[model samples]
Target chain A: MADHKTKASAKTSSPSGGEEAYVPPALANLIGYYLRIAQEASFQAIRQGTGKSDLKPGWYTLLTILSENPGVTPTELSKLCGRDRSTLTSTLNGLDARGLIARRRKAGDQRSYGVKLTAAGEAMLRKLQVIARAHDERLDAIVGKDKPLLMTLLRRIVDELGNGYPPPPARGLGKTSRTR
Target chain B: MADHKTKASAKTSSPSGGEEAYVPPALANLIGYYLRIAQEASFQAIRQGTGKSDLKPGWYTLLTILSENPGVTPTELSKLCGRDRSTLTSTLNGLDARGLIARRRKAGDQRSYGVKLTAAGEAMLRKLQVIARAHDERLDAIVGKDKPLLMTLLRRIVDELGNGYPPPPARGLGKTSRTR
Candidate 1:
């Protein structure tokens, strides 16, 4: 077993006149490293701009989904978010406890519940959307006018990752179609 | 305050029956989301492939850095990784304890120490790199032939995000010197 407590000492004199050393660039460009840093920065900004008491990004996603769909079920929310059903359940529970959302049993199915935002939840989501928009703008500003291009490229990458292929062109308005 | 505990309960539901709820297309397209899912999948695979005891991604990075530049410093490592200096301190302590790296005082600098990987560290890095290559191949297979294009697009996004300009043209050839 690797020793869990050994500290690798320096091989040369410290640049700072003390013993603090640095790592190299080999690790810098790794995709995971970049993602972690970007995510952390975004999350920190969101937490600070909005009160920490509000919905986190995951929770906010659920709220946004419900708002758009009106009465989405928990299972649907799970699939949409790519979260396990178990994780969505707990996240929903937190939202319900905070009065940000409510889950009521569907008309016929005792096991299925329809989720929607409460008054407080709606207010919170509205406020959060404002913060999110501002944060996104800041992020866009950081990337400058190339934001659209960046978004397109990212979307292409994501689309490639999933099984779905890009859609074919819409039906018949071309010269051949008119002849037909 | 949000009930953190209740959030845990939401995770227990079954996910089989809900309609395909709408995910905000815009959110789905964000680079952050794809980067996150990809990283999560990679890390999970690493953990599973390595069993419970092999060095994880961060540790592998540290070792790689040490092997590449034998006398780097902890503060430099933290900066390169975008991790907090304090966090690097703890992680370095763990690596040092494991006898995979060594920390030695610089000849002239009293306050900074240089870091290097031990022979054990080199061997471990080689092993992990093999695993990582396999892992990356799996990911590429998951994404299909678009993997290269996806990586290229992601690299472009990072370049645009970290620096507000389009990437410079390939090395050694000025714009005027190139044949169109």
Candidate 2:
């Protein structure tokens, strides 16, 4: 079993000479097993990095996308974040009130609005980007040389999983999404 | 950019002569981005599979752990699932009410209880296990033969990230946890 092997290897190879290795269930062999836990770590790391900030849990994703595609529609942005429009509105409104993002009707398409990062929004994004970079660096330090390997696997899972499964109703990010 | 390349590749390589390929943002390069979306997919799959089940989100992990380790302690289960005692209590009580898990004082240690799966619990777990396997197969079909590769990569991330970052309150699973 994977748990048995990991425990045995840890017992023989550990420098601490103690019970450092944990015996995980057989389900640990599944990708779902690790996703649940690793996602928790990722969520916590983001919280630690963005603590007490005005941005909500999913805000950074919104800002990052808006920065990349300046005239993106709210509906398209909602699709990108895999969030429903209603859940996204309050966060978008918060950013708008803070003057971090601006919404305007497109010249030709009055039905849809273009969302963009303002000068202040861009400035805030720069700060958030720094925090994200540092957080990512910490993950890289742990994942080490396999960091790229892990990224490829995750990205592949996202693409492949997306191919098969319809996105769930984005109800506050399943378990991780929350307002600060 | 990752999205640009994806958009370009999709534009050029589309056999359907249409736009099925999605251009993910720069954040898609990060593990958190994929985790959030993948977790959404996993949640929907499970919800669809277990729509009327009384068991909540964290119940599967609890049942899975109990079935594996018949006399495991709550503290140990908490450690394995990365949940706190406070959060585990509510879930444990629900399982207890359902007569799925039994908590009894250890023969020697009068203070601590050793939790085990009841007969009904084991039966329910077997049924849930069926749902879990089919669900995993759906994911496997998506991830393809590379399922093992993705699983290994995820396991490494969990171990490596866990060493650096403490568990994130174990707030219902961040992604998905399933039976073996």
Candidate 3:
């Protein structure tokens, strides 16, 4: 750590000092502020955990979705994840290129298709499940009470916020380097 | 809504069907998972509430910190906010451009300087505090407990994560449009 600091200092400047965590007076209680902190923590954990994998940030969540909702279509997947379909496409393309997922057109509907986990995709998700479990355990240590109470609260916010937001048709063929 | 769908469909080919929110298998329990959902909600709420203001998603939080820790330097503010100084420069520059913040070097301390809320900065924060308060009240309605418990749990997670992440020095001069 000290060595890195010295190297970094040599490149530009000295270390920033006197950083007592300032819980922004009222911002801490604003729900959004805490949400950013917690989400950033989760993002970091995923980045660290999947550092060696080809999977992008938030792709594990997509894989988990495909694992649970096997045979789900891209549109369905988008709605399930609340991510725009344009966003889902690039992610889908990457996982597809890696042989982790397979896309199959529905028998009658040629334009739309179902997304399935290839054997490799399922295998990757299983490994991620373990890492995710560890992440959950770490959070469990902090949140306590198994998180149902907290989830219950968060779910309520999602429910109320979901109202009146139009679901859009997803654009096809976009780059999918999801950065969490 | 229909028009958006029509336009989107025209571009995308067809409507995607069957998007029930897929609860991520076993990950719904992770505090981070809940954190993403909760954060998205707060983000949407802020988008709705402050749609007219030039304040970007996170600038409000930065402003709140400066409001609380008046006369803090870039290094100290970086520490207080758990962000690298290099990351803070653009954000500081933006607020400074808006005439909401001021920075000055300390006597005998050429490198370190203090950041204070300009009267405009204070006034904007005061206005934002009201909007932020109303945002909190809506969340409080959803969380049902005014967030002491939730904030405490999240703070714990932030504290645990803060350790081991090296603080970097703030770069001298650059564009400071920090998105995350």
Ranking by lDDT: 3, 2, 1
Question: Model 2 over residues B9-83: C-alpha lDDT tens digits?
Answer: 222111211223244566756666666656655655565667667745557777887888888877667656555
* CA deviation > 4 Å runs, candidate 2: A1-23, A55-57, A105-113, A138-152, A163-180, B1-23, B55-57, B105-112, B141-149, B165-180
- In angstroms, give how far residue A101 of model 1 lies from its true place: 0.5
Spell out the clash pairs found in candidate 3. Answer: A90-A176, B85-B170, B90-B176
Indicate the docking level reached by candidate 3.
acceptable
Angstrom error at residue A124, model 2: 1.7
Q: What's the interface RMS deviation of candidate 2? A: 13.9
lDDT, candidate 1, A1-180, per-residue tens: 111122233211111111111323553434444444455445544555554565576666767778877687877676776566677777777888898888888998888989999999999888777777776666666555655665554443334333212121222333332221
Give one clash count per candidate, in the order shown.
46, 0, 3
Per-residue C-alpha lDDT of model 3 across residues A122-172, encoded as one tens digit per residue: 988888877777777777777777377777777777666544233323454
TM-score of model number 1: 0.61
TM-score of chain A of each: 0.70, 0.73, 0.74
Error of 1 at B28 (Å): 4.3
| TM-score list, all predictions | 0.61, 0.70, 0.77
Per-residue lDDT over A34-148 for candidate 2, one digit per residue giving the tens place of the 0 to 100 score: 6766676567657766767775555677788889989888877865655545667788888999999999999998888999999999988888778777777766666667667
- Residue A34 displacement (Å), model 3: 2.3
Name the TM-score of chain A in model 1: 0.70
Segments of candidate 3 deviating more than 4 angstroms: A1-4, A7-20, A164-180, B1-22, B165-180
> Which has the better DockQ: candidate 1, or candidate 3?
3
Model 1 alpha-carbon miss at residue A98, Å? 2.0
